[model samples]
Target: MPTLASTNAVEIDGLGKRFGATVALENVSLAIPPGELFGFIGPDGAGKTTLFRILVTLILPDQGRATVLGRDVTTDVWDLRRRVGYMPGRFSLYPDLSVEENLRFFASVFGASVEEHYDLIAPIYEQLAPFKDRPAGALSGGMKQKLALCCALVHRPEILFLDEPTTGVDAVSRREFWELLDRLKASGLTIVVSTPYMDEANRCGRVALIQRGRILAIDTPTRIAESFGRPLFAVRAGKRYPLLLAVREYANAGTVFPFGDALHYTDRRDGLMPDAIASGLRDYLRGRGFADVEVKLTAPTIEDSFMARMGEPERAA
Candidate 1:
């Protein structure tokens, strides 16, 4: 049996799982160092939740091995459970319970007290203190997430696993939640978070892009975007739909996809200067009667890299 490395807070090798005909994870492998803010970036059904559940000891993997904090997920589950804090994707606390009740309940589960770990959750608890008397279900989305986070942290676990902690919250709330995560990371906590939002990748120290039960790439956000390694341009015109179609129909078009309010275009020909490619594309659109066409060279984003990788053939395990 392979032993978990001492340096890794979490480790998985050839981890896999399935639900009858549905494959949740396939040949997944990765290592997370302690105190790192690691992120699993993917859309829904990409196996992020499954991977998290296994690490948190909620479920067993069908094959391969995984360990959290040097404890085997399958063998040392009882000890691991007490050492890790997990905030599931869904709100699992009693909706009828008041905010304070929920926090106290979770603390007691691990044989701890809210007063014992009060310092750990003080920052987040202060916000929820005002709503301590309100039913958990009655709080706004942001407050509910904060309360859930408090419950998860009340036990003072060595590592934290949050499954899409910011999903379904308002944009302002999302930003605030990330700020809280940043503070936790600075406090030397190893946090493993999964989210479908590509923009959030920037906040992670390192991220793994998972799709269809496999990892496409894993690196720092900037490096992952830089790996898109092809001349790319963002083109916009009066009509986005027509512009997308026209760009896709271009003979030299390598990849064309609608991004935000513009179309991100890549060319088939390599080694061509970006300015030349942009000029040629502008002329082509002008000739096609899109008089107000604007095509400019733009840097690739993490989403662009994910989209590009999604089109390639999957690697062999």
Candidate 2:
């Protein structure tokens, strides 16, 4: 089969999409290399779905251009459809159908059989094998996710687009789903995935931090976290809500936000030592009559970097 004509499996130039007065996507441009696992990191309404739909030919862009496998998305959508696999954010399979039946139906759509491409989906399918006779709607959230993935891969497409594949699933299922993607990547399938989870960003080979339908930063997770360019600290105490507000009111607080059980923060005082900052934070919380407090230097994470980028002004890429 003929594949992409260039090293890039997907390319977008100034892509824009709007629904009524709302801008679903704005001037989005990106290049996805062949056989690479690229992630579109963002929350809901960040235009991740809109961009994916355009690339998949499910919708048309109001402006700009995009190509899939080197074929124009607008004019060559049929060809693109045949070469790419897309697992939408929703589980759109026939819920009433049994697992094997659904898989066979999707395979037939692409004029292929599940057995013909079983190896491509074996890792994920194996997890759902026992439930092959169960109705899709009756399966667990994790199993439904796996079944959707198998249906998407049944035709052996060269590239895969997964939109928020982990949302609503349990933590263990989410991790397992990503592990499956990792295996797929190792097998030379180019994959594009979108997720709101910051930790999932680290699992991708490269990620594009997006917000409000714009690209914030595009690089490996390590580079994006390192670009924070601020001394970060984590503070925790009893009464987490009040602690968050109190930390934000600190005079030297550059950026403050609750992170898991601790508040991830940055100091505004440019050259202040970590010890001094921690001391000041501890004293401030203590002075407010709260005895329990722990403030210390903490490494910046992908969430911290994403929040930092969210606060910064958008610059031209």
Query: How much lDDT does candidate 1 score?
Result: 0.93
Each prediction's RMSD over C-alphas, in Å, is: 1.9, 2.6
Per-residue alpha-carbon lDDT of candidate 1 for residues 1-317, written as tens digits (9 for 90 to 100) = 65455689998899999999999999999999999999999999999999999999889999999889998999888988999999999988899999999998999999999999899999999999988999999999999999999999998999999999999998999999999999999999999999999999999999999999999999999999999999889899888888888888888898899898889999999899989899889999898889788988889999999999977854433
Best model per lDDT = 1
Q: In model 2, what is the error at residue 144, expressed in angstroms?
A: 0.5
TM-score of each: 0.96, 0.94
Query: How would you encode candidate 2's per-residue C-alpha lDDT over 1-317 as one tens digit per residue?
Result: 33357668989889999999999989989898998899999999899999999999999999998888898888888888999999999889999999999999999999999889888888888888898999999999989999999998999998999999999999999998998998999999999999999999999989999998899999999999998888888888898988888888878788788788888888888887889888998998899877778998888988888888887665434
Candidate 1 segments exceeding 4 Å error: 1-5, 314-317
Residue 24 lDDT in candidate 2 = 91
TM-score of candidate 2 on Cα atoms, chains taken together: 0.94
What TM-score should be assigned to candidate 1?
Answer: 0.96
